[model samples]
Target: MTFPKRFSNLPEYAFPRLRRLLDCHGPGGAPLRMSIGEPQHAFPPWVAGIIAEHAQEFGKYPPNDGTPELLSAISDWIARRYRVIVEPDSRISVLNGTREGLFNAALALCPEEKAGHRPVVLTPNPFYQVYSVAALAVAADPVYVPATAETGFLPDYGALAPDLLDRVAIAYLCSPSNPQGAVADKGYWADLLRLAEKHDFQVFADECYSEVYRDDPPAGALEVADEIGADPERVLVFHSLSKRSNLPGLRSGFCAGGPQSMSRIRQLRAYAGAPMPLPLQRVAEKVWADEAHVEENRRLYRRKYEIADEILGDVPGYRPPEAGFFLWLPVEDGEAAALETWRMTGVRVLPGAYLSREVAGENPGKGYIRVAMVAPEQELRHGLTRLRGCLFG
Candidate 1:
């Protein structure tokens, strides 16, 4: 049997790699999970009632793009949150999750070649793995740019050489990024959009953690693109209920872009995409419309932010997360720190290297560990304390 060589060089996924590295060691104290960014907060209690009310819809095929109601709700939320008007029918495609849109949009948008060469897909180092997989699936070269402290933890695509930039077909960016929790501001999005226009590439904005923010909401790609008056099809923004509403299992999200881009995305989805279940879409309609539950959810995450600051404030190189739930902490070596912390404190955390790839013999995430602050207040405090003492002490 033969397999495609496109994925031959891919590394083992983050979680299974962590298990292989740590499972042999006996933990020194009570185990606490601070590894995966699975939210532990309460989803709205009303969710159950909504699902039950729409249960019979399970017998029917769901709308490929989205139900008109669900799309309207999502567009209305965008208007309220981003202060931008979008026509739901032509601009948005409902997703099972942002991961789906992030992967599939590449398939639907990337050209066979750019500048008469195999197109390049740009991803930030220590990025969500799906982005790289999507590039490989299309036989494009996956170029990893470093998103380190020097670059504000977001990949600096503008810095690439002109020759390299011209070969680019798509660039994946995550604001309020996974693992690092760095939020890309208005300037960031504007600069990226401008670059896309000049370079003739599309920007795939993965803003799943937009709602898990603190203080002012992070500037969105949509509003920025509108302000700068760039091509609408140049940017596709992916958002999710998973991080926003603590509904990861709900698998509800949406991708919004210009008409042509969306047309292609939806067309591909019609043939290959699994339409989200009607029951879940019905529940998502309410979830997208309701901000009360979202407000309460943000309040909980704010407390977690405060707890993290109190516990890890003095640790050198510890930048408080601007948004999202993970703490990207610098250490001497990520895997070693994770092993020592688990053996000494029983706190499970992910080594940052697992989320990054090596280019030119260096993995930028090798010296950091990503800790997910998803547990309740007290438990989070316990885990942070142990992590501080075990790793920093």
Candidate 2:
């Protein structure tokens, strides 16, 4: 049997590689997991009642785009959150999760070639793994840009050469970035929009962690695009209920952009996308409309943020995340630190190098570890304390 050559160079996924590295060794102390970003917070109690009410819809095929009610709810939430008005019917497409939408949108919007050459997709080093895979799936050259501490944990796409920029088809940006937890401000968004307009490339803004923050809500891509009057299609923003409402299992997300881009995305989805089940869509409709539960969820995360700061503040190179739940704690070497931390304290963490690509013989994340703060407050405090004593002490 033969497999496609496109994915031949792909590295083993982050988690499996982690299991292989740590599972064979016996943990030296009580086991405490802080690896995956799966939220352990409680979702709204009403979620079950809503799902039960819509259980009958399971027998019917879900709408390929989304149910009218769900779309409107999502649109209304956008209006409330980003202050941008989006027509639910033409400007938004519901996704099983942002990951699926992120991958499929590239298939729909990326051209076969740009400037008569193989297209380029820009992704930040230490980025979510899906971005590179999406670029490869579309046969675009994936250019991994460094988003290290020197760059404020955000990729500087504007620094690319004109020739490289001209051939770019899409740039994947995650505000409130995963691992590092850096939020892009208004100026950052505006500058990026201007650059996109000049280069004629689409911006894929992964804003899944938007709702979890330390201070003011982070500026959004669509909000900035509207302020600068950039092409509506120039920015496609993806949001998820996973972090926002502690509903990772719900797999509810949406992508919103200009009509042309959305039309292409929706058309592609109609043919090959997996629509959210009607029962789940019904649940999502209600979830999007409610912010009380989301507010409570953020409150819990804020407490955890305080705990992390208190525990790790004195450690060298400790940067408290501006937003989001992960702490990108610096270490001498990621893989070695992870193994030692697990062996000494049984507090599991992800090696940062696994999240990044090697460029110029250097992996930017090689000197760090990513610690998820999603466990309960006290449990998370215990893990952080163990991590500090074991690694930084």
Candidate 3:
């Protein structure tokens, strides 16, 4: 039997590698998990009720694109949040989660060749792992662009050489980025949109953490594109109920783009995608329609932000995150910091290098640790204090 060569060079998924690295050592104190970004905040009280109301619908096959009501709810939320109008029926596809949408959009939209060459897919260095895998799945060249502090933690696609840009089929961007927690500003979005237009590429905007910011909502790529009159198909935005509604287990999200791009995505989804179960879709519908719970969720994260700032402030090289839940804390060495922190304090965190790929000789995330601020308030504070004492002291 022959295995696919595309994934042959890929490293083990982050969690498995982490387990191998830390599971052998006994935790020095009571275990406190600050590793994964699974939200510990309570979801809306009404979610269960809505799911129960539609429980019987689980027996029926869900609509591949989305139920009209669910689609309308998502559209309305987009209108309210980004002030961009997306046609519910034609321009949106409900996803099992944003992960699915993010991966499959590349398959659906990226061309086999661009400008008479094998296409390129651009991903931020410390990105959601799916982006590179998706590019490889399509046999496109996966270009890992550095999103380090020097670049404001957002990939500067515009800075690439024209030859590279011309071969780009898609560029994956995560605002309120996963490991770094950096939010791309409106100007950044506009510049990227213009670059995409000039180069003839699509922008896949992973905006899952859009709702978890500390101050004003993070500017979205779709909104910025709309403002600048960029081609509607130029940007595809993925959003989720996972972070916004504290419903990771629900696995509900949506992708919105232009009609042609969405049609292609929907066509692929109809053949290969697993639609959200109807009951879960009902929950997502209501979740998207309601913002009060999301606001409360943000409030909890805001408090955590304060706690993080208070605890880690005195530590040298601690740069506070502008948005998102993770703190990408600078360290002498990510793997060493992670192991030492776990051995000394039992507060588990992911090594930043696990989230990034080595480009040339350097992995941008090699000198940091990504600490999730997703634990409960008290536990999170305790973990941060112990982490500070262990790693920075």
Candidate 4:
């Protein structure tokens, strides 16, 4: 059977495509994988103990929204991190992971049409792939706006024609943006929220990488929305323990917004959602309440940041990521850089093109490679040094 036409043009996923590009060539030295953004830093040691304590509850069905305690913990965390207060019962949906929430948001929210024509879903060109897929899944027009060095590594949705803005039904934004690692300041968020209001679209703020920064925390969409008195329904913020807690396998995350939007999303989820396991939910409750561990995680990333800067700081076109763990390194050609680095130095990294889409014959990621700063300190230093010599020297 022919697959849906909407999905016909979807590019191959990043990791698998990387394998295809590099697996055929044998490593020239000992292998060091810094390709995908999988965290190698230690999660809290207590995480496992908590899971063991609640292992018995795995058999029981989980709360569809969230346990009262878990919700309270999430609310407390948000209030602390973003200074945005939200009522759990009415505005939060405990997600299995942010990916589930991100993808399902489009399904639950995107309407059949906008402004009397096909609706548009805006995303950063070199974005988390889920955003485009979500738009396509809902039959909305996926608009890839470039988030390049020229745009402060954030998509300039405001530059789109006013007519196009009016047709936008949803806009997906990632702060501490993937690959680029640029954080959107409060001012940027306020402008976007205002644009959303004027254009009549929803904002999906993916702040999953918010906790992986060095200094001042990134300004959150909901935080700015509240400060500016934007409609609560206009923005939905998704956060997760994956990057923050380095518990990617735990698959725990959440979505928070206005009660009305939460109601519609929760309704869709009740029919098609994988609620977090009751035991996992209990673990999340404790995880969310703790700040010590989160701080430690941040400290580790901070060190890596220094290491990266010291190594590549002087390289031409080397833009130090403002936040997040990935390094978006510049090169003449991303694919060539990745392949040669793997073959000569045995350091594996992802080509930037994999994360972007070409519009008007220009793929924003074509001249870069994405390296994950998730390896151990010494190993990361060696790997990056090798990469530097192989790709740049």
Tens digits of per-residue lDDT for model 1, 162-267? 9999999999999989879999989989999999999999999999999988788999999999999999999999999998999999999999999999999999
Structure candidate 2, residue pairs in collision: none
Query: Of the candidates shown, which would achieve the greatest lDDT relative to the real structure?
Result: 2
- TM-score, structure 2 vs. true: 0.99
lDDT of 2 by residue, 41-78 (tens): 99999999988998999999989899999999999999
Residues 201-238 of candidate 4 have per-residue lDDT tens digits of 99999999998887898999999999999999999999
RMSD of each: 0.8, 0.7, 0.8, 0.8
Give the per-residue Cα lDDT of candidate 2 at 51. Answer: 89
Worst 10-residue lDDT window, candidate 4: 384-393
C-alpha lDDT values of all predictions: 0.94, 0.95, 0.92, 0.93
Going through the candidates in the order shown, the clash numbers are 0, 0, 0, 0
* Residue 108 accuracy (lDDT) in model 1: 92
Cα lDDT of candidate 4 equals 0.93
Locate the minimum summed-lDDT window of 10 residues in model 2: 190-199
Pairs of residues clashing in candidate 3: none
TM-score of each: 0.99, 0.99, 0.99, 0.99
Question: Can you tell me which runs of candidate 3 are displaced by over 4 Å?
Answer: none
Cα lDDT tens digits, model 3, 1-393, are: 999999899889999999999999999889888889999899999888988898899899988888899999999999999899999999899998899999999999989899899999999999999999999999999999999989989888888999999999999999989888898999999999999999999999999999999888899988999999999999999999999999999999999999999999999998999877999888887889998998899999999999999999988888888899999999989999999988988989999999999989999999999999999899898899999888877
